[model samples]
Target: MYELKTKENDSSVIEFIENVDSPKKREDAYKLLDIFTETTGCQAKMWGPSIIGFGSYHYKYESGHEGDAPLVGFSPRKAKISLYFATGDTKREELLKDFGKHTTGKACVYINKVADIDVDVLKALIHQSVAFLRETYPNQ
Candidate 1:
């Protein structure tokens, strides 16, 4: 059986932020923490070693692979911050159009810092991502 490597753990989100090497990145991480927390109305949890996540849902694939993942999350990486959101969400694409300076991948929206993006748009992304996951998976 294949297991997900990035499962949630009991690590301290603040501790993780403190250990981040870059001072500016550390500050950005705290800001993201606050944004995600306030926007989602969910407390931040450490996902794997690096990703700070909020809320969660379980998903079972058609292939029978199943796992629990955060509704919305972000990582303060060395080069840039990586925001995690539901993949294949059309609304997400629409919001990204006004999300300010950012790059996209299948599941991650990369941003240099919080100031580089509009916080309101980011909140919309969080709300939409959480709503989409809940509607799609329907599993707590």
Candidate 2:
């Protein structure tokens, strides 16, 4: 099995975002990063090569696999921004209804542009996701 990397470096995260080719995309990345950090009250850092993740939660399943992951986070992908929020039992449509124009796949909420979505709605989703993760994975 492939193990998820747990270590994070904020400087590397910034450098990665800065290297993005589009100025608008770069700006949007930082905007999303700021919102996630502010709403979750958790520091943000890069996960792997692309994801800007927030906070950390450790979890172990019944099958005895255990690992740590970001409690809430998002990645600015080429086609759309992916917000990772599904800890299961998410009120996804309720959140997305307020999020303006966007799409979704599995647990990720995909946004084509930051301007396409209401910033306040995005912040609320981040907060809600973090709260859900905390509730679901508490002490686990």
Candidate 3:
């Protein structure tokens, strides 16, 4: 079993974001970080080397896989901002239908720019995702 690091290294998070060369990208990242942390009630942390993660949960699968991960998080990548959460093909499908200007992977949603999406809708999605995760992984 691997031990999970609990508290965030705020300096790392700030330094990493600050080092982003693009002013626009850096601005966008900080903005998203504020929103994500505010919305999730989770302290923002620098995950690994680049991800800005929020609220964490511990999970142990029947197959023996176990770890701690942010209940919800995002990565402000070069071209887009990636939101992480679990998904069902149709779950939150309606929300996605209404979520503005973005792309989706299996469980990650990508927003090209904050100006392109509805912030309220994004919050709703985060709430829904967190709720779903809580229900799905009750023990966590």
| Model 2: CA > 4 A from native | 5-11
- Give each model a TM-score: 0.97, 0.88, 0.85
Instruction: Give the whole-model CA lDDT for all candidates, comma-separated.
Output: 0.93, 0.80, 0.79
Q: State the local distance difference test value for candidate 1.
A: 0.93
Model 1, span 46-137: residue lDDT tens:
99999999999998889999999999999999989999999988999999999999998777999998889999999999999999999998
Candidate 3's residue-wise lDDT over 9-101, tens digit each? 455777888888778888888888888889988888876666778877776779987777777778778878888876763567888888899
lDDT of 2: 0.80
Name the candidate, 1 or 2, with the larger lDDT value.
1
Those runs of model 3 whose alpha carbons end farther than 4 Å from true positions after fitting are 1-11
Best of the two (2, 3) by lDDT: 2
Residues 1-140 of candidate 2: C-alpha lDDT, one tens digit per residue: 85766445565778888888788888999998888888988878777778788888887889988887787788777877888885575575687888899887877888888899999888878777778778888884
On lDDT, the stronger of 1 and 3 is: 1
Would you list the rank order by lDDT, best first?
A: 1, 2, 3
